[model samples]
Target: MHDDMKNTTPDSHKKKRIVIGVSALLVAILAAGGAVAIYQHSASAQLAEAKSTCAQAADRLRVAQNKYSALINGDEYKSAVAVTDKQVEDGRVVTTLAKDSGDETPTMVACNVEDKTALERNTGLIDKNTTWYETHAKTIDADVKNVVKARDAKTLKDTQTALGRKITDAKKLYDASKDKVKDDKTRDALKKQMDAAGKLKDGKDVKKIKDAQAGLEKAMKTVNDSVKAKQDADKKAAEEKARQEAEAQAAAAAAQAQAQQQYVAPQQSYTPTYTVPQQSYTPAYTAPAAPQQSAPQYSAPAAPAQPATPSTPSTGGNTGSGPISGGHGCGSLCTSAPTDTYVR
Candidate 1:
């Protein structure tokens, strides 16, 4: 039993030494693993930080690049091609940096920051220029529109003046023509048309003026035609009156000749006859009557013989030797007197 106990004790001491060595090796490995885990965790954090920084830079560059593209495409900034191209180059450099490994070098970071700053500056300039161009374009457009409106107004004014002159002249012509027209209806119609044309005064309505001008021209034509017709009628009336007067004169002459033929002077002759006159006697025979003896009867003394006068013919048949007058139907030897004979 004593010799067995001594061998067990040596075996137990060897086993204890083995167990201690194994425990020491396990502790060393665990310590080494913990150090490796801590290093990996630190590396992951650094990678995440680098990625976040690169992403931020990429975002900035993208925003700037978008701004530059928009400006270059826009109407206001299309002319700024040279400046926009430089900005595009800067954005390309930033894009390259962002696409590289997350472990960004100091030089790359610096380059990206510089490129981003340059892009921001270029984009700002483009924005400013675009804004200025937009404002300027609006101003120019407004000015052009105003100028066109002014020119149109001037043209309208000139046209109105010319139209006024034409209307005045037309009115003068119409007045003259209307005066010449003798027809009441035609003259009144012409006046009405002229009045309508007169309503086309100077105004803003061009259509009204043109319509009035047409009316005026039509009225002028009507007046002229009326005047011509009236003139022709007057000429015809004058000719007819002259013909009537000539006919009247010819009829008067023919009537005079007929009256002269119907009223021929009657031929008349006058003859005178002599008659002896008896004279009465009484005074010288008174004494002889006293004696009463049968004396010779005293006859009345015969009248002394008178000389006969020649009868003259009367030119007007008014003269007559008889006491009675105005006798007609006398013979050629008898004297004829005229009663009342009117010569036509």
Candidate 2:
């Protein structure tokens, strides 16, 4: 019985130990699960915060870019300085925090911030020049039109002045990166564009303003020459007609004189036949005074009828149709000696 009791006691102790070990393992597993849960929640919350900050930075960059567009396009906009301030303010804190976190992503965030700063700076410079170009382009276009229209020497001169100024300004803007741009190809392209614009704006270039002016002058000369020629022809014709009329008048007078001479004035009745001594002596009466020679009338040689030169009209009377001829006063002048009309 003692042996059996000893064996039973050992079995009971073994069972108790087994129950204690199972309980301790269960407790350890539950503790480990709780720790993992807390860690996951904390990590998710930090990720959310970081994402929100990044989003704010991105939003600021977009807003700054929009403002830049406004400035470049010449719309009323926030001052450039104000836009820069806002961009930096929004991005600085996020960048600082990202750097402090010592995470691998901080380098990327830093680079993004730097890029944004550069964007703002470049756009600000470009915007100023773009605004200038916009205003100057309009002025130049209008001035060129005026120069072409009136062929006004003064307007042409002013256009040259304005274009020169614009070219200089554009050159300065484009030359900024000449030494600094890393890409040689891009730099050369920029320079070429600037040079082209400058050359086109040059007043001395035959293809530019000078050419248009020359064309206008040539057009005017042609018109003037045509008008003068027409006038001269008309005058010659008028003089010839006058001469013919004068000759006709002289001829008519001569004929009338001859006719009068042919008529023998009847001898006064002094010799009248001694027919009827009682009959009163009646003198044959000559036709009352022959009609006085009236001055010959002449039709003005029809204005050297200018051959009608068809021409396209100009919006402004001063500018003639394209450099084609008949550019001047060759229109029909009915009896009026001269009239100003634009012909081309």
Candidate 3:
């Protein structure tokens, strides 16, 4: 039994050695396979990124063309060309990098070739668009300024006609550039330029000229209405002043006639009047008559008796009758007596 175990052990050890060598060879083959798989995967990812970047660069070139067309129509061409040049440079870099890398599949190789060819063609198209836009922009600027400066209606109208001619020429040059571009990115860019030019031709663009025409028409109508209203007011005022003067003249004439009728002449005259007061009657008084005067008679008283005397002697003469006297007494007596006695 010991001898048989020893004889099989050497052959088994040889088989074991073969199995270990085969396992080591399998591990090394697996590691190599993994490394190859990782390298292929990394390379494929970079190629895809390169293609996507190249495509974006193509889109930028188209945008630069559209901006250039608008600038030409609006008289801004210098800035437009600068933008296009920068986009073209970026696209060329991406194309060169993609062409040199590993691409195992036939389809990947074809895609890479096609992308490089497209980039070379785009370079010429971009230059053409830039050159045309700049030339047209200069002409448009001068034409628009001349139209605004014209002297009269006839001259201004003539200037506008010339501007229309320049716009048509620019539109032709823009169309020729569009035909050279083949890709979707280039075609889309050309379409935008066509649309902007169409707006200018139709007179639909927002511009200073259109606004100025509308303002002038409104001002002329206002001036005409104001002139007519002022003439009517002046005529009415003159008529009112003439009527007031006529009424004042008639009133002055009537007052003068009434004053003339009140005049009179002057004179002086005199008249007299007599007046007496009345009296009542009163009675007069009378005195009574005096008595008459008469004469008076007177009576005497009685006397007493006396004695007788005796005789004297006697004489003798004549005695006649008587007798004798006495004689003596006794004796004589006797003698006388005797003679007387005898005569008797």
Best by lDDT: 1
lDDT of 3 by residue, 300-335 (tens): 101101111225544655334333355223244234
Question: Model 2 misses residue 262 by how many Å?
Answer: 7.5
Residue 235's lDDT in candidate 1? 96
lDDT per residue as tens, model 1, 187-238: 5665676566566665787677767767767766777777888899999999
* Candidate 3 local Cα displacement, residue 321, angstroms: 99
- The alpha-carbon RMSD values of the candidates against the true structure, listed in the order shown, are 26.1, 43.0, 46.2
Q: What are the clashing pairs of model 2?
A: 223-328, 327-343
Per-residue lDDT of 37 in model 1: 97
| Candidate order (TM-score) | 1, 2, 3
A best-first ranking of the candidates according to their lDDT comes to: 1, 2, 3
**lDDT value, candidate 3, whole model:** 0.41
- Candidate 3 residue-wise lDDT at 279: 18
